[model samples]
Structure formats: structure tokens, C-alpha cells
Target: MFFVTVDEKVKDAGPDDLIMEIPKLGTKIVCPTYFLVLPYEDFDYQDEDEDYLPERKYSVAIVLNFWKHTVRKMKDNETRYLPLLFHEVGMGCFKVIKEKNELRMAFGFTDDFAGDGLNIDRDSLEDFSKSVQSIDVLTMSACSPRIFQVTRKSDNPDEPVVSFNISIDECIQDVNNSRNKLR
Candidate 1:
């Protein structure tokens, strides 16, 4: 679940001015945050093997907006505000691992293009994981552009895996900065 806090003091505040706070987690996210939840059953794959199914019941997506476009599009007396609304700066996935007693959050760029990917070390990942486990909330974000396809040399060479270009450390710093501003 997501909790939004609007600063009434700011007159006509934009998206950036709004604060998103995760309940039970004191960190205040300054960016405009959006969440998308998808159930595993919603997928239409016809795999007969039950073991192949995902263990988690739901997958949560976190989308952050950093900027808004000035240009607006109008069509026959109707204004369409979709992809033109906000500039998505980052995105990530969240999952709850009941067996491991951990909240897993993997953050990356919205797409695989543009900025160089950020590498995260084991220590950083563990620290962040421990911090969020208290609230059982997993969060991820990526600061990159464009999503594309790539081939991997793993055991299943034919299978494709999605990759991101942002580091969890950077996302942590952003949250900390926003929390400080709130105080």
C-alpha cells in the first residue's frame, strides 16, 4: 500500500513537491510515486507444472515521476493526458519472500537505454534489505531510459531476463534526502 502526503504550505505544488510515505517505514519519498499490483494468476501462461508457477501471490511495481511536460495535446475538444503527463525518472519491483523472511526490492531504470547502469554490492543490498524487512515492504527503482531485448549466455540461452541501470544505493540516498527535507 502507498501513502501520499501533500504539503499544504506549498501553493500550487507540483508533483515533486508531494511526498510519498510508506506506512511503518518512516522514510519520506519526495518523488511522485505510483504503485501497480499484479496477481500471478492474472498471467495467461499455460504451463502445466505447478512448480513453475511463481511463489508470490502478487508483484508490486513502483513508478516515480520527476518532471512534467509543458506541452499538452488536444484532440477534438478532448485533452489526452497520458505518457505526456509526467517524466518517469525511475521504476522498480517489490516482492515479499516469506521463506527467507526478507523483503526483496530490485530497482533499475525505466528502460535499459541512456545512462550507464549502477552496480550494487552485496553489503549494500543486505543493509537495505534488512532495513525494509522490519515493515515487510519491498521497494525498487531505476534511473535509466528505454527498454530493449538482449540475449544471455546462461543455462537457458533462449530465455530473456530484464536488467536495469540504477543502483539501490542511489535510491536509498534519495529517500534519505527526502526524509530530511520532511523533518
Candidate 2:
């Protein structure tokens, strides 16, 4: 198992950027490439029912596609205890925590997705590994045609989000070269 840590010094990265840059040097994102888990503090979201509010603060996790499918089946929103594993690559969790005046971000894997919130079934890891392998690129593409589509928010015209023009293959090469280092 492997663990990766990302700090604020890291630049704003897209899905492909994150995928290629984090995992094994020679591996590829044969399955789903991105898992953008936007926690409440970093982002603001209003559901259909305005009265209800999700109490959890801002958090984000970028895991392998298999973990994503496994998590989807679990049908819960708590992400604190999710262990993200990729056979070809490594494994880790994406965490955003507060450190005095700054918010520290890190990504990596451990023995289990341990948290106070929920219990993770250790056996399910193997099951998820086999399940996601059957998923082909065509299915993944159809599921997310534009895996990373960045655009300026309508409300914030002056403040623009950064977008990358690099191709997936190019991003993969960049990742291969960097290994665990965030470029």
C-alpha cells in the first residue's frame, strides 16, 4: 500500500492532471480517472430543499475508479474512512484538515479507511477490484464524456478557474516522470 500527500503549495489541478501525477510511473488510468469529492467548506452547494444542510465541512478525496464504484454501492456520503486502492498504481485518501491558520491537504492510503463515522468492510476491497476491471474505456467515456471540463463560474466573472489544455497521454507522461511528487 502507498500514501500520497498534497499541500497548498500544489497548483490547481484538473482530473487528468491529478490522476497521471499521483499513481505508479508506468500505469495508466484504464478505468475512471477522477473522483472529485467536494466537501462543504471549500465549496458552497444548495440542494433542492433549502431547509436541509449537510453538516460535514469541506473535504475531498480522489481515489481509483474501483474505489469509486465500491463507494457508490455503499450509498453513504461520509468520506473520512474510505481507503482508495489501485492495483496497478498505489493507494491513498484525500483529506483536507485545518492547521491553525491554514487548511492542510494530503492524499495517501493506510491499513483501513478508519474513521468515527462508518465501518468499512475489508473484504469488499477485493470484490471492488474485480468488479471495476470489467469496465471498459468506452463505458467510462460514456459515463464522463468530458472528464475535466473547467469553466468560469457565472457569479464570479472576475475570478476564473484554471484549466489545462494538456492531452491525457501528455498528462500521463508528466505523471510518470513525477511519480509521487505533485507537479
Candidate 3:
């Protein structure tokens, strides 16, 4: 068998690069590194025994689906599809904003995460939110964007609203890929 490494920074694999399997490739996992801390009284959680605890125990997470173009041979011809690739290189947190039918997402780099390399303070976060209105989500044929907003009782206007959304098509494709892997 042959192996190839899709560049670590690449979010989408081109058609030619998608058909082969990458041998000895280590698994890549990406998850939210920081969660906004709201008032403890606003959060809730249950234990394994189904008993409610005094303090909240769960945190938030953001998931993004990355895709790669692949072509497969059929009896008479070939078909192309943008398949979901579970690689960390193309996934991260995004700040989502919605005005009407469209949802805008700006990449949230790790550098700006709280207490991180380029930690963002309160004033900086507000400025960041204002700047995001002009940005647009990159359109992809295989994925559809959806956004859901969350608000906390004590949340102020300057505080960022946390939400989660993903490319439904890519998510479904990922599920199918996982099933195929099992077989």
C-alpha cells in the first residue's frame, strides 16, 4: 500500500490526494481549549446517579467539520465527493454571527484564547466582535452552515455569545465514513 501526508495545514484535500490512505498517520484531535466562565449559579449538571450537583460540572465545546475531495470509480464512470476528514489541521473554534438567513464565522485562533499566547482581554474581545461583521464564511459545496445562539442571564453586551454550528453535509458524511471504517 502507498501512503501520503496531506499537508498539516491543509483544510481540504484535492481530488488526487483524497483517494489514497495515509499509512502510519497518527490520529489528530482538536477540541475547545477554553470555555467562557459564566456565573456558577446559571449552569447545571447531573451525576451518574441522576442526582443534581450543587455546582455545574459541564463545559462547552465547538466542533468543526473539514472536507476533502475524493473520486471513486464506478462500473461505468467515476464520482466525486467532498468527504469529511477528521483531522485537526482544519478544525477550530469560530465566532458565529447571524443577521438573517446567513451566518458569519470568523476563525478563532489559539493565539488569542484567554490566558494563552496572545490572550485577549475584555476590551479587545469587544473590538474583535465589532470587526467580525464585515467577514464572511467561506462557501463550500459539501457543507451547509447552521448557527445556534446561547445567552446567559448575567451576560453583558460586551461578552461574546457562545454558539455551535457545523456543515450538516460534512457531519453526515463523517458518520458514513465512520460506519465504513467499522466494516
Which candidate ranks first by TM-score, i.e. highest? 1
Tell how far residue 104 is off in model 3, in angstroms.
Answer: 2.6
The whole-model lDDT of each prediction reads 0.26, 0.28, 0.25
lDDT (tens digit, per residue) of candidate 2 on 1-183:
222223332233223333223222222221122222222234333342331111210112322333334333432222222333222232333332322322222333332322322112345544333323122211111222243222222354233122122332343343333333432
**TM-score comparison, 1 vs 3, better candidate:** 1
Candidate 2 residue 145 Cα shift, in angstroms, is: 3.7
RMSD of 2: 16.8
Q: After superposition, how far is residue 87 of candidate 1 from its true place, in Å?
A: 1.9
Per-residue lDDT of candidate 3, residues 1-183 (tens digit):
112122222222212111223122221212222122122344332322322111111111111111111111111222112211212223223444333323332323222223322112334333333333232222222121222122233224343322233343433454345334323
Please give the lDDT score at residue 31 for candidate 3. 26
Clashes of each: 7, 10, 0
> Lowest summed-lDDT stretch of 10 residues in model 3?
56-65
Question: Which residue pairs show backbone clashes in model 3?
Answer: none
Model 1 residue 134 distance off true place after TM-score fit, in angstroms: 27
lDDT of 1 at 102: 19
